[model samples]
Target: MTSILPLILFVVISTVTPGGATTLATASGANFGFSRSIPLILGISIGLASLAAIAGLGLGGLLLEFPSLQMGVKALGSAYLLWLASRIAHSGSPNAGKGLAQPITLVKGCLLLWLNPKSWAVTVGAAASFALLASTPNRLAILLGTMFGVAACMSLALWCSLGVLLSQLLRTPGHWRTINLAMGALLTASIIQTWR
Candidate 1:
């Protein structure tokens, strides 16, 4: 149990911190409510787990071999995140006609992580750091993937719940605009931090 504590800490810290996915989850909760954000939460968890599994299966080595490829990914991810931030920043209140009418779908949520440089970094780091979790590489992959999935589910839910609570306090269109802009700025900052 003691040996697993570090892994737990790492998972919790990685998932709970404000990042692109967590920011999106919070915005979803605030705009669409918790029930509507469930699909996105599940998709993010599953996508994170899958990425961890892939990293453990040796994608890390591939990235290490091709530094240019990694740079390409980071560049593409940053551009995509910038676009998402713009959308969030411009979003109006749910009650207002200017806001997004539909919640993000499961597939979109999954793809978001896949395109996020931070998610890749976290998964690859976890796969490398927790190599001792299992004897075999395949077993380690499964264990890390499962662990990440569970942790992500819990942490992201908490973020979403916080958003729900904030939504209650921010009912007006102006208040929601403020929240959306703040969320977008935070997400943009996260992206900038990832590069540095």
Candidate 2:
């Protein structure tokens, strides 16, 4: 009851923030439309929830114990984000040739969630902070994971919708290129935030 309030607030704030998942969702929606971005949204929601569950199950402590492992994960995630940013920056128009950039696939979306250091940070932090509220760690993890899944879905959908709306304004190739570059910059910023 009262104790769950903080957990809820944490989930809301974390999910609503512009992270890798949200940025990718927006970019996917802008490039491929809402219907095509469904797989990406689903993958992100499922992957994030699973991560939260793992954190609650005490794997997060293992990560904390192994600083080198954590650093490795962060390095991999940062590198992937930089690559994604470059792709976005150079993406072709929506109606371009067959070689135009495609939206992220479900597998890649899931992988991104796993590799995202921010996801680990938020999930592990939430699980640790809210563990005292439940009788068992598993119960706490399940509760947090469920809440995060719902909040993330809503937040991702909102960002995706915003992208779809913005797509209406991008009529020319130059317009799309500019928008893609801006989105790429946003993704780059997310990586920079992780480093800080």
Candidate 3:
């Protein structure tokens, strides 16, 4: 139980905040609806898990030590979030893409994860929980890390569902615009917070 604290902490923080994945999820939900967002969610889970695997394999520690590098990532992530918000703000109508909305493509979803700094942090920090899982020399750690990956994916689904709920509730274009701006600002603020 104690060993899982780091994982819990990372999830709790990243899930609630307006980060790349969460912000994009909400926009995708509002634009494409729940049915369409499924691919996005799946893509995100896989993308993030890939990062987690890399961190588990050892990369985060190197990046984490470089403050400038981390800051650069934050700036890039903030810019992307702002771009996504703009896209949502101009997305025709709240109901424009209903019948003909395209699903969130796997490539787009994966790209979002790669560009998100918060995703990288989560992947790195998550490895801390089950130290044994991160122990490269210990075969047992690899198995445990794999288990953690599964749990993380499940949790991501629940977070994506909240975005779906918001889309259903915010049925008007005005409401969606407000949501877009709010999500955008939140992401920007999160980036600033990271800097502070």
Q: Give the winner by TM-score.
A: 2
Cα error, candidate 3, residue 53 (Å)? 1.3
Q: Pick the candidate with the highest lDDT.
A: 2
Tell me the alpha-carbon RMSD of every candidate: 1.6, 1.4, 3.9
Model 3 Cα RMSD, Å?
3.9
lDDT tens digits by residue: candidate 3, 32-147:
67677778777776777677777776666777899888878777766765666556545544556532146558777777777778777766766654546334624333543454
Q: What are the lDDT scores of the predictions, listed in order?
A: 0.85, 0.85, 0.63
Let me know the TM-score candidate 3 reaches against the reference structure.
0.72
Q: Residue 42 of candidate 3: its Cα lDDT? A: 72
For all predicted structures, in order, the TM-scores are: 0.94, 0.95, 0.72
lDDT of 2: 0.85
Q: Per-residue error at 136 for model 1, in Å?
A: 1.0
Question: What's the true lDDT of residue 10 in model 3?
Answer: 60
Clashes of each: 0, 0, 2
TM-score of 1: 0.94
- Candidate 2 local Cα displacement, residue 44, angstroms: 0.9
Show model 1 residue runs off by greater than 4 Å.
none
